[model samples]
Target: MIAYDNDNIAKVEQAYMLKTECLFKLKKKEEATKNNLLLAKYYLDFAEGIFQNDIQGALRCVNYYQKGIKLYRDNGEPQKAEIAHKRLVEIQKEIPQIMVPFSIELDIKGVVDNIKINMEGLTFEEGLIRLTQMFVFEKQEDIKNRVIGEFKDHPLAHMFGKRCT
Candidate 1:
């Protein structure tokens, strides 16, 4: 029992140091500032998880880590969030990606509201389709070009413009 307690204490201390180091590195990666903060928070959370019974300390750690995450997000470092979020998704299978619909009202009414397409674990292709469907009605040539470029061999590309002739 003593050994187990010692192990937990060691892990918590190591995690705390790693979190501090990550925060220090964050000052250097200004562009990836958000990502660094996320990494730090993850380490902090891991440390807190090791000391779950210490209710007050755990709560304090949670608040501090949450604040770090919030600061990064509020500062518009989505790429940083994306990195952490991807890891979260791998671990828990329920991370939400920002899939801005191309046409929210139309697609919501036509497809989402009526059909029960279970795209829970859909691949990138299917996800792209869902994202594209939202903007299908909009007549934005640039968006169309981008979509076509993204899915060059996609069957729908031909419908948008001239075939590769």
Candidate 2:
């Protein structure tokens, strides 16, 4: 439990797997199911933490989420399974990169709300174009490029490394 809260993922996983196996063998179905439920949840957090930086992290995240849905259903928690499914669906809608490669989306609404960018209800590409115009008008060329090129497939990626007009 300490290892789990401290993010020592591998150790927590090993302990849970072993404990659950022993519990199942001893005919402790309820205990085994509860352990699996907890482990599946741990996987959700672990995968979400790593997905942004590593490609394999995304794959593992989705895989573990699917596994979680199964675990939840097996434990007679259909609502939990549905919740995981809805979360996965929402992520896929916001970031299709989960299902396909080479395209990523920056959540403009979040930027509008958190960073106060005021580009609400706009597409990312439109936002990028507006950003380029703003930075160009303000003569902040370096910042423009860095912000525009934040993602590999950024809408203005081709304009990067070039002086903005």
Candidate 3:
């Protein structure tokens, strides 16, 4: 058995401060997407610490996560935004389900093989046709050109570039 500390408030504050310091250091790094993801996680952790005592504090933390999602999506980083959104969904489960004013509706299906889209609620038949036309039967040079022009420096870009060359 372990002893419990009565100074829980102090401990939470200390942890929050340490995370804030780490976030400040991360802001200076070049990985903007990674930095935002870490920032959201830290904020969520801090919010979880105070949720029982402070509803406002918990909501503030969720707001910070939403900002991270926006930043990621705006920077052409839908994968990172999806990550933040998933975290937000998990956190939201602890609170009431009332929809927030700034909620975003992302139709992403999966991240494997370059972020498969959900096809905007299309039926199975339509989706199959769209997939076949877009992926299965698309010409090689067209796919290569689109990937190279849009996904420069991406792993997919490098892989396709090698084949193109």
Candidate 4:
């Protein structure tokens, strides 16, 4: 099949047509043949989703990946099956970061710094945006050894000679 540019609809359509033709060619073959067709289709869909920058579509690709992995395993292609499973797992790890809500708790000096914000049901990207909009750091200080941090004492401190009020 032709690896056409995804940016061009006509080319993409042609590619799909070619893929369909390939699928037709694989019809009435052994179980391995059907599995191979499924694998190819999944790969094509996954690549297209990534190229289009469609997060939902990309997530859908995970399902296809899982399907392909199972088919590969059933077809006795253990190595390819294992690789496909790994790829699906890797994709799953990133998916929660994008689609799932998460909470980050930071502790400073044994004190739980209260953000006092509700980030529930917000994706990672949305949470970052909300945090940036709501919180503004006017200034920051580094307290090292209970004294005003200096360049000699704290190489990490950016402000010099600034003490805590």
Candidate 5:
């Protein structure tokens, strides 16, 4: 049971987490559960503080929000858990899109938009990657190298097992 004060969010979070763990070990189930809830909310506050400075922190927020929701539910606070659960879903929805550069996203979308085949068994990413592969492999070596060079510093191609290099 650490009281939140002017201390930085991280310190407050650590204190609550340690207290929650200590309480559980002392056979203080009720106190542990309450502190667990506090620690969960602190996770949210910490993540939101990061998010305010950088929207890219949504990736980090996903983990914190998921932990918060679980802690809330396990502590008999399902109503509180639901709020965090919705935020988790929204963060998950935004993750795949957030890291991709605008130009790269447009390139992939251009391929996806003009596709002639039915990508019935594929995710949108799988289908786009298939097209990128076909386009890359069909080129003469010089052109192939040049096109891949464009994405050399970008991660989406490499992340999907297609090395742009």
Candidate 6:
């Protein structure tokens, strides 16, 4: 039996994890698996207590929880481990998907003239807005003329026209 010392929970938890890892590494140790399994559960429980209300800590706890579940399953304690597995899955599913931006640069030479034109630093929304103003707003002839005169031979002009249509 291990003595409970609330003030030394962190140190105790680290000791448990180290002991569990050592037991797991031993090849011919009798009942070492069971001891490691129990130690994993104790470490996870301690980690959970320290992780309350902190997202990064919660992520760390998920690792400990996963380790505990693996140990529990190896020791034939499936029922208890199943709950941890389910919780881990729930937490994983709750993580938000992150979107990354992709950018491309195109260079064009003017039609009926030889002026170099570059359209960069424009977002998808900004490109859409410029296209809309070109096709939908007849009063914006100055902007339309500039675009057509500059990018008449550019590949993106056809795409912009298709989007407008």
Question: Arrange candidates by lDDT, highest first: which order?
Answer: 5, 2, 6, 3, 4, 1
Model 3 accuracy (lDDT, Cα): 0.57
Give the Cα error of residue 94 in candidate 1, in Å. 21
User: Which regions of candidate 2 deviate over 4 angstroms?
Assistant: 1-8, 97-165
Count of residue pairs whose backbone atoms collide, per candidate = 4, 0, 0, 0, 0, 0
Q: Order the candidates by TM-score, highest first — what do you get?
A: 5, 2, 6, 4, 3, 1
Best candidate (score: lDDT): 5
Positional deviation of residue 2's Cα in model 5 after best superposition, in angstroms:
5.1
Error of 6 at 117 (Å): 15
Relative to the true structure, candidate 3 reaches a TM of: 0.31
Model 4: lDDT of residue 12: 52
Which should have the higher lDDT, number 1 or number 4?
4
Error of 1 at 74 (Å): 3.9
The C-alpha local distance difference test score for the whole of candidate 5 amounts to 0.72
* Backbone clash tally (model 2): 0
> For residues 72-135, could you state the per-residue lDDT of candidate 6 as single tens digits?
8877788978988887777665432221223444443242122112224567787666555544
lDDT tens digits by residue: candidate 2, 96-154: 45434344455556444643454666789987776666543555887687766675557
**TM-scores for candidates 1 onward, in order:** 0.24, 0.50, 0.31, 0.37, 0.53, 0.43
Task: Please tell me which predicted candidate would have the highest TM-score against the true structure.
Answer: 5
lDDT of 1: 0.50
Model 6 ranges with Cα > 4 A deviation:
1-14, 17-30, 93-165
Tens-place lDDT per residue, model 4, 27-73, is: 73464365465544555455435632445755666765766666666
